[model samples]
Target chain A: MAKILVVDDSNFQRNQILRAIKDDGYEIFTAENGKIGFDLFEEHSPDCILTDLNMPELDGLGLLKLIREKNTDVPVIVLSSDTQELTAEKCKNLGATDFMNKPFKKDQLKAVLEKVFQ
Target chain B: MILTPDQEDAIKEFINIGAGHAAGALSELTESHVKLSIPAIKVVKLADLEKEDDSFTKEISSSVRINFKGFTDGTAALVFPPASALKLVSLVSDEEFGTPDMDSVQAGILTEIGNIILNHILGAIGNIFQQHLEYNVANYVEGEIIKLIEPDDSTPDLVIMIIDTQFNLKDLEITGDVVIFFKLGSLTKFVEAVENVLS
Candidate 1:
């Protein structure tokens, strides 16, 4: 079982997130969008998920809600370019673990994952 | 809407800055020197834009679009030419060209690239303007290009269309768009920021 599930519509971002977390020795599974992400989530039940807010089909928020409905405890961190406080608040209210602005630092990703998985 | 002289200059300057940032980010990611030229900015009636040679349609056969509301109400999109998109996937994946599936992988790469480029541009705008903006969910579609442009109910406003021409060190051309919807009032502020930064 992978410890992390990196979900986004972008290969570059998925790769960047995967590269950042690979050193933690956690198996990583990736999905292109929310629909596939949810399917993978059900199958692998990863400890944490890093997702992009803007994605085709089911978006990050929709995926977050779906994942919460199935297993509310899994950490779902939103990664998006939209930095409005309202978006962050909405994600938090919907049971997201945290929100990280896009183009995040390497240490920030590790720190957030540690906080959630610890 | 015809922009004042100051607004035109500001708009150009704003795009120039945004393009510069995008170039830096692409260079870092690709590890190849990348150069981006200032996109020719234009403000034409929607009807006029639709009738112009249909180059955008030919360039992007399929796309996924997302409309961002708040601060600015405009549509942003991710458009991919089939062959060029496939080339990008091959470049990023280091996979041998052996009939790899195109649909899912192509969608994945384009969506990610669009996400990065759009985010970088929007983030730069937010930084310069000192306002926070939020993005809506991305909607995927594969069909005629005309379907991408629907009438916005948010009162007709200025549409800022930026055509990104990316060139790697070897002159590999990766083309994309950064379209922003601007409300009239905020459009003034945006223009001011452009002028301030440029002048």
Candidate 2:
């Protein structure tokens, strides 16, 4: 089972994604903010990371940097509601595996993961 | 860094662009032909919050806040008084209703407004300043404005740029405010950007 780390400040958003993929048999670990998300990532070493862009203490970009320090190839997907191309571009330059806008469909997640695994 | 006269004018003009664009966007979204415009903008400490602002913040029942990070980082919040909140939801959703309340359903409806308003406002800022800021999902809460945007203990006092806007939705004279709280050092950076653009 592939393990996924989910990081976001909003519980509603976190639950929405988790519900979408919980039955896929992927083990999921969740964190409220980037600081704890990074700690959980270090502890769990999830196969991939799904994170929100903005948070207190440390943001998703900061967490992405921390992840890339030790593991360069982990698929980090940013799930954001912000439609700013600049933010998506920033994620790509920072080595993110994918960027999915909010209110995404189940098929969208599945497709991204399939590509990531392939 | 204290703002020079040129810096102040530039910032004001920058906000004018952002707010004007946002108002147009709002009109398009609601299909109500509403004219939303900012009548005044100010830089103030929380201690000096205007009386109407103080009362409005206290009376408002719902708010959506988005955090942004760039040359400056802070939260931009659009808080609506209960009457105005109800009006906004009805207008945006095109649902006829009376006595609006913040249930799970209505909150979802208002979140749409928040997303559009905040994103367009930020988009305008990003376009003008040539700064790409990372913004988060709108954090929605039902409470007083101050309680919802609780100050972290580390930064108890806030330096805010308040954009006081008049949103004339049909006959209802509702007001919404975009309160931007810039982080410690970012205020200086933002002013410098304004000065640079003017120069």
Candidate 3:
């Protein structure tokens, strides 16, 4: 089973993401902020990481920077409502495997995960 | 109106970029072509919101409101009148319109839409300022315009910036307003940040 870590500050968003991927058979772990998310990442070494861009304590960019410094192979998909080309470019420069905008469709998310694991 | 022409121009450009992204998000989510009209920016005292425009005072609307702090503090919302709100939810969701069960579904769908739209705009501001912002969870509310923008503890004398932009979607042209209010002292901080970016 693939382990995936999902990090976001909003409970509603976290629940929505959980509901979307729960039936896919991946072992899912969640955290409310990037700090907890990194802690989980270190402990479980999730196969994939999905995170929101704006968050308290540690934002997605900070988490991505932290993750990239230590591990290079794990796929980190950065999600945000900010769909600016510059935002995506920054994530790519920081070594994000992919960037997905928030309020994403369930099928779209699942397909991205499938692509990542494949 | 308090802003100099250069500052106003800069702010408009910033907001336009944000609205363009928001339009794209709305278009993809609704499977409709969304077009954004130019934004009209105004600074108004909290107590004078009703005097500023009929749209802000008389219209009964459904809105998803998000509050944020950091870099600046304020509220942002996606507001639609009742008919437009119903039309939008009907276009996007599987639920039949006017049904009893739709009340909850409408709130859910709109809240998510608001979350996406507001975040993109605020995210643009954050990026332009190179600062981090913390946002509260998005909330769905229904009321007249003043009720939509006023926080519980807002001082009546404080001034705010109101940016009103209209989004026209598909052939139906379901109109919605993207309203952002920068709280009292935050408007100055916001404009200063914009000027800093421009400089």
User: What range of 10 consecutive residues in model 3 chain A has the weakest lDDT sum?
Assistant: A79-88
| Winner by DockQ between candidate 3 and candidate 1 | 1
Instruction: Name the regions of candidate 2 deviating beyond 4 angstroms.
Output: A1-85, A88-118, B1-5, B50-54, B153-156
Model 1, span A18-69: residue lDDT tens: 7787888888999988999999998988888888887778899899989888
- TM-score, candidate 2, is 0.63
Expressed as tens digits, the lDDT of each residue in B72-136 for candidate 2 is 78888887876788778787667777655776766766765676677767766776777887676
- Write down the DockQ of candidate 3: 0.27
- Write down the worst ten-residue block by lDDT for model 2 chain A: A8-17
> Which sections of candidate 1 miss by over 4 Å?
A1-16, A27-51, A55-78, A82-118, B50-54, B57-64, B78-81, B96-102, B139-144, B151-164, B180-199
Q: TM-scores, in order shown?
A: 0.67, 0.63, 0.74
Q: Order of candidates by TM-score, top first?
A: 3, 1, 2
Chain B TM-score against the true chain B, candidate 3: 0.89
RMSD of 2: 6.3
- Write down the RMSD of candidate 3 (Cα, Å): 4.7
Q: How many residue pairs clash in each candidate?
A: 2, 0, 0
lDDT per residue (tens digit) for residues B12-113 in model 1? 666666667766655555566778775566654444555555356444455656665545556666565555556665665556456633667656655555
